[model samples]
Target: MCDTTPKTPIWKAIADALRSDLAEGRYTPGDKLPTEAALAERFGVNRHTVRHGISALVEEGLVRTRRGAGAFVAAIPTDYPIGQRVRFHENLIAAGRRPEKQILDVEERAATDGEAKALVINTGDPVCAYHGLSLADGQPIAVFESVFPLSRLAGMASALQDTSSVTEALRALGVNDYTRATTRLTAVRARATHALHLQVSEGDPLLRTSSVNIGEDGQAVEYGRTWFAGDRITLTLES
Candidate 1:
C-alpha cells in the first residue's frame, strides 16, 4: 500500500487564507474583522485555532487587536518625506490626512552645548524652544521640540503662540524659507512620556529624528528633535 498525504498545520492554513483575503481587499484598512466565534464556525475549528491565526496577522502588522472589541485591520502608514523643505502639515495633507498640532510649551531657554553648536550660538545663549504634539486625523503621530536662536528670531515665541506651525512662525520672523541641513535618525523604544503622548504601550517602537535647519544665508536657524510613532508614519528620504 502506498499512502501520501500533505501535512500542514490548520492554524497556518487559516492564516494564509485570511492573508489572501486581506490582499484581495476583502478587508480594507481600518475594517473590523469577523469575531473569533464567527471565524471558528466558518473554519470549523476551535476558538483557540482561530485565535492563533489572528495572532499571526497581528504579528504581521496586518491587524490590530482592540481590548473587548476584537481585531481590526491596521491603517496604511502615512508617507512622510524628509526633504530640504519638510513641512508637517503639507506632508500629512499630501497623504490625504487631516493634520493638527497642539503646542505643549513655549518659552525662552538657555542653549545647551548641543543646541549651541547646531544654532551657531554660544552656550547659555537665549533660545526660544517650542514643544508640541502633531496629530493626523486626530491620532497623535509625533512629539517635537524645536529650538531657535532668539538673537536672530526674537519674536519667534510670540509668533508660535499665534500659530501651531513652526514654518508659519519662522515666516513671521522674516525667515522666508529654510532647508534641512542635516538629519540623524535612530530607532528607540518609547518611554513612559512618549508612550502616553503617542497612545502606545511602553517599549513600543519609535523613530527619533535629530535635525538642523539652515536659512537662506546658510545660518542654522532651528534645531529640532522629533519622536514619531513607528507604526503610523513611514519616513521617506528625498534627494
Candidate 2:
C-alpha cells in the first residue's frame, strides 16, 4: 500500500531528493538533469512543485534552467591554491574534463570607469578585453570578460587565437609570472549578453565572480568578470 499520508511538502521533498543526489555524486557537475515531468513522476509530485524545488536550487547557485534545453547540474569550480597560480584550462583538465572557449570578441578598447578602477589603471587607458564563453564538453559553463592593461600586455589582442584561455594568451605575450587572485562571488540573474552566451534562459540565476590577479611584484595584472551557469557549476574553496 502507498503510504500516502499526505507526506512532506512536495517542493521540499523534491529539493531533498536533488540535494541527496548531489551529495552522493549521483548527479555530477556539468550533468544535465531530467525534465520537470520526469522528475515529477519520479517523485510523485506535480510539475509545478518540481519547478519550485528547482528555483530553490537556482537561488543557491546549484542549478540552472535553459530556455529550451532543461535543467543541468553545475560544474565544480576549480579553486587555485591561495598562493599558487593555475590556468583555467589546466584546472579543468586536472578535473578530467576538456576545456574549450568560444570567442565572442577580442579587441583593444578604452577601459570604462569600473574596469579601469578594478584594474587600478586610469580611466580611458587602453585595455585588451577578451570576452567569450568557456565550456566543458562543448556546453557553456562560464561567460568571461578578462581585461588586462595594454602597457603590461602589448600586442596581446593580436596574438590571441580562437578558443585560447587568457592565461595562454598572456604567456604568449611574455608575461608568465603571476601570483594568485582574490575572488568575490554572489548569485545574480543572467544579463542579456550573459544569458545569450551561456545559452540559458533570460533571468536565469548565475554565479557572478569578480577576480583580481596580482603579479609576483604585487602589481595588479588582470581583472575579470565571470558569470557561471548556476546549475552547471559550483565554487569550492580549500585550505
Candidate 3:
C-alpha cells in the first residue's frame, strides 16, 4: 500500500536544509551564504522562496543580512559571565577565543550628573572617559564606555593609551583590584553610531549593562556602560 501526506512547504524545507548544514559546521561564523539565485537553483525554488527561508534564519539569529551584501552566518552567542570578577581577557581566553579591544577614544571631561552619581563625584568634576569596541576573534561583539573620576585616577587616559586592557590600565595607577559593586541590565535598540561601530543594522537588538566597579578601599572607581550585540553575546548570571 502507498501512503500519501502533505509535502512540507518549500521555504520551510529550504530553511531546514540550511539549518542542518550550519549544525554540521559546513559554514563557519561570518561565512557568507550563497546568493539567493544560487540557492534557488540548488533547491529548485524561486529567489523569493529562498529569501523567505533565509529570513527565518535571520529571525533565529543564525544569519544576518547586509544592506548591499548578502546574508551571512551569525556568530554563535558567546557566553559571558556577570559576577564579582568580570574580566574581559580572562573570560574570552577561558572560552577559547582571542579577545581584543579597539580604543575608539579617550578624553578627560566634566562628569555629567549621571556619571557623577555613579562614581560618587561632584557634577562637573573631571572624569576620564574611555570608549572602545570589544571583539572576539576579530568580530565586533560589544561597545563599552568607562568613566573614571579623573581626580582619583589621574593617569587613566595615559594608561589606556599604552594598553587596551582596562585591568592593566587600572593596575598601573596602583589599583590592585576592583570588583563589581552594582549592575543594571536592559534591552535597547541599536543606534546608528552603535550600528556603525558594531556592524549591526540600526535598530538591531542590544543588551545594555550599566555598572559600577569599586576599588579595594570600597570607593567607586569606575562607572561603565557596555552595549552588547544581542545576537553575538549571551550575558549569564551566577547563582
Highest-scoring model, TM-score: 3
| lDDT assessment of candidate 2 | 0.79
lDDT of 3 by residue, 198-222 (tens): 8888898999999999999999999
14-93 in candidate 1: lDDT tens per residue?
Answer: 99999999999999766789999999999999999999999999999998775556787777889999988899999999
> Per-residue lDDT tens digits of candidate 2, residues 73-128?
76565432222464677767776777788888888989899888887899999998
What lDDT does the true structure give each of the candidates? Answer: 0.91, 0.79, 0.94
The per-prediction CA RMSD against the true structure, in angstroms, equals: 4.1, 5.3, 2.6
Point out the higher-scoring one by TM-score: 1 or 3: 3
User: How many clashing pairs in candidate 1?
Assistant: 0
Candidate 3: stretches off by over 4 Å: 1-13, 37-45
Q: What's the best-to-worst order under lDDT?
A: 3, 1, 2
Candidate 3 has what TM-score? 0.88
Runs off by more than 4 Å, candidate 2 = 1-65, 68-84
| Residue 149 lDDT in candidate 2 | 91
| Runs with alpha carbons beyond 4 Å of true place in candidate 1 | 1-54, 65-73
Between candidates 1 and 2, the lDDT winner = 1
User: Local error of candidate 1 at 190, Å?
Assistant: 0.7
